[model samples]
Target: MSEADGIVYSDVKFTRTKRNTRGTTSSEAEPTYSEVRILKTHPSTELPGSQQHPVSNGGSKVTPERVVIVVLSALLAAAVIALGFTSLDNMHTKQSFQTLRDELEAVKRNLTERHCEVKSYNTVQQTSPQPPVVKENDPCLKCERGWEQDGRQCYYFSIDLLTWSESRDKCRQKGGDLVQIDSRDEQTFLELKVREKMKNDGDMFWIGLTDSEKEGTWLWVNGSPLNERLTFWSASGPDNWAVYNPDGEDCVMMGKKAGAPDLKCWFDEFCKYTRRSICEKPAETGHFTLQCV
Candidate 1:
């Protein structure tokens, strides 16, 4: 190949032998040589492809299309795995909530059924032969549920402890105040009830009377002066032997003795101490008749 006139030219040689009339061929007698030049330039290298790209893994080049497919497949697999776990977690949470709802429904059903049943077959309220006319001294009245009836009053004994003021507030909420003993009969009745409630031991409880505002000048919830004539005090009672006795022993309390079933169980206590309470209020008409529960 050569370059001439701003164009590339190629030369090719050829040999030819002359044929004899006698049908004899001689290669050594005649030989011919010819030169041919290519006018157009020819390609010497291969062309690149648009349909594919090369990828290598230390072996042979691979197609870019195949590599993309593999990457897409891996991503798809990871997405599928993540979705599977998320869906499973959601299902578990749904199941847990369903179980809780079922348990709550079951508890509600049990409570509804229990509320339908009464305490006992023999438990029944008896209306008086006629509505008893209430009076001031010896009134005939009725009590409410969880209260005891005595003459014209309704009394309630607390099972929990509260400070004297707290107990008074609670009693007032129930339409009463801590008990105020008016007579020895009332005191005896209260003592018997207390003994019945305490079974084996004695418990301290608060009353309405207090000397808190003014020392020694005790008063009742009705603002009545203490009935100094009719009183119950044990041996060395009202001694005010508390820690800050004379000053802190402002609230009145009742303490029972195992052997002493007397009204002399009264004592002075700190108004801040937590203790049971006795509440009393005037009975209402058509209220429940008191019975031992």
Candidate 2:
């Protein structure tokens, strides 16, 4: 038998028995055959319900649970990488902004400092001393007693208490005459000075303007005519010798008090009243030229 048949026969057996009947005389020889069948089951080496075919161990045989876990782990790793990049970007942006802000602050501070420095320099420049433009000429002349030098002219505030004619003569003796106010500023200045220095109350002061030498012809001691519009005379003033002096009224005198009236007389005899006087000469022009030279 083949090896496969032998293995099968080894698990099975057959048995048989024979019986003889009497009455069959003469040599009743009865023959009987017996056969016996036996079945035997063998124990297999593998356990019950075990796989009949070998299973392959390839990567395709992975379990569902293991696949889900691997996918989740990969997703988690990607999330972490993205978060790291975002954090780095944020940090870089913050640093750049901080640097810009610091630079701006430094620029502002420098500008402020420069502005202050310029202002200080300008202030110093303004305060520095500058030279005078006018030159000194003849030393100021000293006026005689009762006379004072004002500007380039000598002025006398008379206290002599003399008649109009005597006053005129006195001014001539001093090489000057009654004062003439050439400008409003000069007039105001002289008025203030005279008021401050006056001693007599009811006295009248002689000014350079007069119509005395001729009727209605007012002239200054310096040979300049009085400007009728500029004369500070009370209404209807200079009406001296009303009948005999129809015109020839000359000589002007101002009252000592504020709002005092002006008086004009043809004769020097009326000058006895105390009055403030002013004298003037052409302003010295040589000094200005010498300064330029």
Q: How much lDDT does each candidate structure score? A: 0.74, 0.56
Across 1-293, the per-residue lDDT of candidate 1 in tens digits comes to: 55564365555555667677898886654445556655666664656653555665578667999999999999999999999999999999998998999899768645543433222223433333443454453222356679996655779999878999999999999988899999987898888888777634447778888887787888998899998998887676676566664466888888684885867888888788788889999876444432222
What lDDT does candidate 1 reach at residue 22? 90
> Looking at model 2, how many pairs of residues clash?
28
Check candidate 1 and list the clashing pairs. Answer: none
Q: If scored against the real structure, what TM-score would every candidate get?
A: 0.50, 0.40
Residue 164 lDDT in candidate 2: 56
Q: What is residue 29's positional error in candidate 1, in angstroms?
A: 99
Q: Which candidate is the best by TM-score?
A: 1
Candidate 1, residue 240: lDDT: 58
